[model samples]
Target: MGSDNTDRNKPGIANFAALKTAIVNGEDQLVRELLSHEPMLDIEKSYLIDLAQLNKNHTIIKLLENISVKK
Candidate 1:
């Protein structure tokens, strides 16, 4: 028998929403927690813009901009 372990647990809108909420709420710990689980997570490309627009998180926006420049 052959075992196929592909397409396992994947992130969806729920995960995105949760991470967004954590960021919006300024729960850095939670954000770190989620990132630990999803190492490939990209805040700038994800909800960073939306959240910054909504909550006026200038710090986060600046941080994201810095990250983008670095990349």
Candidate 2:
């Protein structure tokens, strides 16, 4: 059987939780990695951006901004 990581494709509780965990834990590398993989987390959800803002995560905000610019 092939290993499946498709769940990572869809934005859900797990994805949101991972992102939130990265942010809350101040894991910059993890946060950047997650954002780079799924830019939609920021584009599709306004709350993520707001959360970044509230947390003063300039790097995350920049990642989101770059995504917006590319799209």
Candidate 3:
């Protein structure tokens, strides 16, 4: 039996949680990597922005803003 694993490989809560951690920790590269692979919803983006703001992460905030604007 053959089955595609693409769906299984899709980012889920763990990725989201990791994104949150990356944002809070000011890990730009990790954040970029996660964002590149995961399609975040508007609510998720907003929440990430809020988290970035809380941490005063201008870099992450700008990154999120740029991506949000592009999409």
Candidate 4:
């Protein structure tokens, strides 16, 4: 995965809202890292792929695609 220094200010994902915020900002590494620690990641679906496609961020779209979310 590539590093994105754009998210230097946002430190952690305290809740689902923060996860959404990370998705909106196209924070791939952060999102992946956070999801690794988030137990609810699979239980709750994240619309990051849609957001990435909507924003035309191919990097994020690809990143999100690689993630396997089991419901």
Clash count list over all predictions: 0, 0, 0, 0
By how many angstroms RMSD does model 4 differ from the true structure?
Answer: 10.5
The residue-by-residue lDDT of candidate 3 on 1-71, one tens digit each, is 13346556455767888989999889999988887643557877788999999999899998887664225
Against the unseen true structure, what C-alpha lDDT does each candidate score? 0.55, 0.66, 0.80, 0.62
- For model 2 the local lDDT of residue 9 reads 44
Check candidate 1 and list the clashing pairs: none
Ordering by TM-score:
3, 2, 4, 1
TM-score of each: 0.44, 0.58, 0.72, 0.51
1-71 per-residue lDDT for model 1 (tens digits): 12333333345555656767876887756655554322334544455657756777665555444433213
Worst 10 residues of 3 by lDDT: 1-10
Output the number of the lDDT-best candidate: 3
Look at candidate 2 and give me any clashing residue pairs. none
Name the better of 3 and 4 by lDDT: 3
Better candidate by lDDT, 1 or 2:
2
Strongest candidate by TM-score: 3
- Residue 48, model 1: lDDT of 65
Q: For model 2, how does the per-residue alpha-carbon lDDT over 1-71 read when each residue is reduced to its tens digit?
A: 23255655456657677977777676778877776453454355576667778889887766656654224
Name the candidate, 2 or 4, with the larger TM-score value: 2
